[model samples]
Target: MGHVFRTEQQALALDSLSRFLKAEVEPLYWHDYRDTFVPKEKLLPVTQQLAEFGLVSGVVSEEYGGLGADWLTNAMLFEEVAFTSCDLALLVLINSFGAYMLEKLASEALLERYLPGLVNGSRFVSIAISEPDVGSNVVEIKARARSTGENYVLSGEKTWISNGAYSDVLICTCRTSDEPRGGLTHFLLDRSEHPYEVQNIKKVALNSQSTAQVFLPEIVVPAHNMLGEKGEGLRNTLALFERSRVFVALCAVGIARRALHEAVHYAQERVQRGKKIAGHQLISAMLAEMATQVDAARLLCYRAAQMIEADLSAEMEAAMAKYFACEAAVKVTRQAVQIHGGNGVTTDFMVEKLAREALILPIPEGTSQIQQLIIGRALTGVNAL
Candidate 1:
């Protein structure tokens, strides 16, 4: 039963999610209103609908009002959403990540206060870690949190924060002490009551998602809002990375698959030299390579998901999956553009959007270079970064 259960249940769940995406999301892909930065009104209805299906909190524990599905199931759901819109997928993904951390590390009182609204999609959350001077270097952040008797005063700036403008709560990392790696701490900030401000940033891609520069000026968080134990934020953040990398890899897989699918469809329909472009060996070779890489990325992503579900040490595996999937997605998107020729560069052709979105995958979650360093350190027992 375990063998059959694994095979059939997983397939059935994926099939259902794929159908949902086709019915609800695919039709909206070409809508004139779809943008990288999803507006609050537009995002609220969609998120509410997804909440009815328990998607927003699928990874959280069932006791906390989530589906409590395994990591592979969540990965499949992420892939399906990406096939529809990467921006929407991100909107949901960031919320899920914040909720997962709160469930795992926050005090029970904190969980009771936040998890319900988060799971029901009534509230949005985002992580604020990247700073103007520190994009991927968590240890070097200058954001400081000073204890002031009854509360902590947080002062600093965070740039490139996803969902920054719209999020109701922010799980932010700040330096609390001067213990180098151990000095960092995580705080749950209620943006509504805080003196923080968000300024949207324009970008070359991912224009539909809200990426912003966040400013905090003596924002006071209750002492109870500290996640985990004081001085343990760095360690907790590292643990969160294991799960975050898997989701990022899944996003890469979805983006790559969609790009390849569009390119193949174009090749089969467009006639060049009195035959379909797909019939030409050059085009066929490109499509073939793209298909192979997409499959490889999917397998690696699933393997990493499985490792996370099995309670194994997946740091190296997660890094490898994210690195390979993101790089492969970039390659696939570039080839997709080549296959479509001039049409690929225009907004009318979806491949252009895919290409733009693919460019950002390597830089988010963790950069491909950072992934390489993680894997290097894992294999060589030497801290290369």
Candidate 2:
């Protein structure tokens, strides 16, 4: 029912995307992505195809190559794509993520230099914000950049960066001073400069996508590379974060829906005690709960997205959406696994992969605990952490 509030154009766009993903993309994701990343050779062709169709920034002005669509349209597209492949969904979103920020904060010359390639899928982008010691605490980031008249020298490390290993341009956060607030600056760095090292990490889940640690030691970027006003990186990033968490919530909603659908399909056919398992009261109750939670999560994500489109403050709304949707996904996927019995853990069933992917949804953008802290502060006007 995500289409409940959508316009006719929005409905048509989402419908078109859904048919394309299911017909052309889902098989590749389910098959090629079983053991490893959908190979770059296999993934890029499809990604470039979608970029030509306007998956970049649907909310931006048409002059910037965006469709002048709404945020809800973009979120709907991503959510539907996530139902097919969370890995591809992530790449789709992150492709334009750093580029959109550049569009917002980069100098006109810089944007002219990079935005087209970024928007059209020729250039790869990554956002470097978290450090080994710092996740949600932006004020404690240890990466440092110092102005050197012509350029700024950067030194620090970032971990858990998606696309870090392959980024052409990286938007990196650095400490410009020792102050807890207003000391941070974001620098747009060219990774080909050889100022940093990236090592792709191996993880138990989401292995079909890239995750890496980035090390920057004395890397220098042009003075104009600073994004947004100096000393305002945290504020800018927080603004981005509020919206990003909602997209992450969409990922959860997608996974939850897919998992719920799979469970229902399985229950209808699997027989136990001379009857289909779906006919059993306890099994039916689990299915009922899963369906209810997935829709609820979807509603929460759409509510947060609508607030973002309205240009309203959504810090608390985003936190609520992220926390509820991700937890809902985890619960739904767990039930799916239980319903599938031993088949759930095997590679033979897609539910196994869905379960692993679901486990990852609550960690990024902000941990559920961090979201709770944000919501708590909003409600009580006191910092709990």
Candidate 3:
């Protein structure tokens, strides 16, 4: 059981959050809006509410108006959120990580300007890394940032950026030099000060969140806006990924858990051949498998979270969690649909949306394939990519 890993405080926090989400957030996501983006205006109210429990200002220390909850606690919170609404969970995730980045790397002035709003959820933030030609390969990033005296003139495009359309601040990865390893740099761009363009990309699922292409054509960012040391973006980003991949895995676990619940509930109620489908051997077997997979995925995610909390290197464990959990989500959700029979493919059922949402989990954070390579590289001590 997940309770095996969580502390009493963490369990209590998750319980409170579970009730809050059910009463306050679930209606907005499931009853009012489905298969469409909740406008930023509506979403902000929920995010602000989440900040009360430290979901928004994640990893930022309490001195900065953040809860400074441990990563394991945060993982539990987000997993609960994803169970209620994966789309909303993602919006919270990007803000949380953005706040963490600012707390960790931003200059005092940069922190003063952005951290408050990000902590309170009034401002949204995004990390821009993937280019049209680059995914999972940070060294090959093509977005260019040229020094111009006191400022850096940035010009490039970033695709598949979550929160791109709504970001108040963007931690963008840019190629500042020609060298492969040290070329990459991180710049903190305020949307109001350094304007850029965004075009929202439509997708198969998670439509309630923004996934967009960000275009920066010679946007001038002050040198002070640079995050961390220059030429250290790749190293910094990789460090973040070691933990982030675990959170992403938890999201997949949440989706699978929901699908499993839906299938079990449906089987108990639906009758086939003069008996409840839950009584049928094949349906029962599917239910058993779904429960096992969901718990297994949850264990892996919690293990990775524990490692991160202990400040251990979880590069290999994180990759394993992400790869296993995301694939489990796809499999479990498909099985949920099959258990629902004809109704599963229809919009009237939540399983349909769960299935669509599950499909997107393996793509972001890192593709399932990329996660496998990371795991393989860890095992063999050889770089496959």
Candidate 4:
């Protein structure tokens, strides 16, 4: 229960990553091309360079060819990535989470086949957990898997899957029985072997990241591909999500930080009434609020990360962090746009893109309303769902 939000070594790591982002990512942001999806040509090299820095699998265990860093370090790295581009950070997050789950739960044979490539960034993976009907109700997911001795046949559709269109592998959750939440099971699906279909989803925000709806028609997965024990998929996936929620919270902090920085720069240079706009009390108040919120959100995110690292049940903490951080990001980004005046609505200024991207943080992983329910359930011991 000790505080895990100390500066110490994490400060050094944050400084290093910040420097890397400034050098490698900031200059690449061009306002001319405001595409919804990141150009693959630009994404690949940056990801490969990040892989070289061991940022992709910083949380994976050393036994799985990773740095074996703790959650605090992992959060720091994720925040840095988010500062550069939320889209790129999201792509890395999807792949990292997939790899972490595989390493933690997959059989040795499965690990040997996928973990190294995944850690090295040679192979990317996506998780298919949200079905069209399931949405936030993990227990209501209708995807089914039938066992056939040596192989399991999976049939389901996953909507809004991150990195679905380009992932080399997929970790899909399906129901294997009718036993409430305990009936769910997870499968490691190799796209090369299973002929699945992926349809790209176009969205107004997070354009640089690929989202898709995946179709599985009798996809055959080997028995060894099963993650953890049968009927434990719901529990296992929830655990993974708890960790992921903290990471996403850090991303929210990063997004808000970047937007705040841009707004501050713009405020100082923009003039009105023959003076710098930043000199005005109203604009100065907005910037001050943005800075305070960013700091508070970052601290909350780090607290959740520290709890996870300390082997604590972080359900409430994760929900609080995710909720507060994302909500704060939305507020700060909107204020950033307002501070920029007329330039805020135009694509020429990066604040417009930042504002658009901020819209996705509250919805993904879990919605803000869902987080409230989670925290409510924890505090009152009532199953609101």
Instruction: Return the top candidate by TM-score.
Output: 3
What are the TM-scores, per candidate, against the unseen true structure? 0.95, 0.96, 0.98, 0.95
Clashing pairs in 3: none
Clash count in backbone of candidate 1: 7
The TM-score obtained by model 1 is 0.95
Model 1 residue pairs with clashes: 35-208, 36-207, 36-208, 36-209, 37-207, 37-208, 37-209
> Over the stretch 230-335, how does candidate 1's per-residue lDDT look in tens digits?
8888888889898898788878888888999899899999998999999999999999899999988888888888899999999999999999999999999999
lDDT of each: 0.85, 0.84, 0.89, 0.85
C-alpha positional error of residue 248 in candidate 1 after TM-score superposition, expressed in Å: 1.1
Ranking of models by lDDT: 3, 4, 1, 2
Regions more than 4 Å wrong, model 3: 1-5
Q: By descending TM-score, how would the candidates be arranged? A: 3, 2, 1, 4
Cα-lDDT of candidate 2? 0.84
Which scores greater on TM-score, model 2 or model 3?
3
Predicted candidate 2 versus true structure: per-residue lDDT over 139-178, tens digit per residue: 9999999889989999989999887765788889899889
RMSD in Å for model 4: 2.6
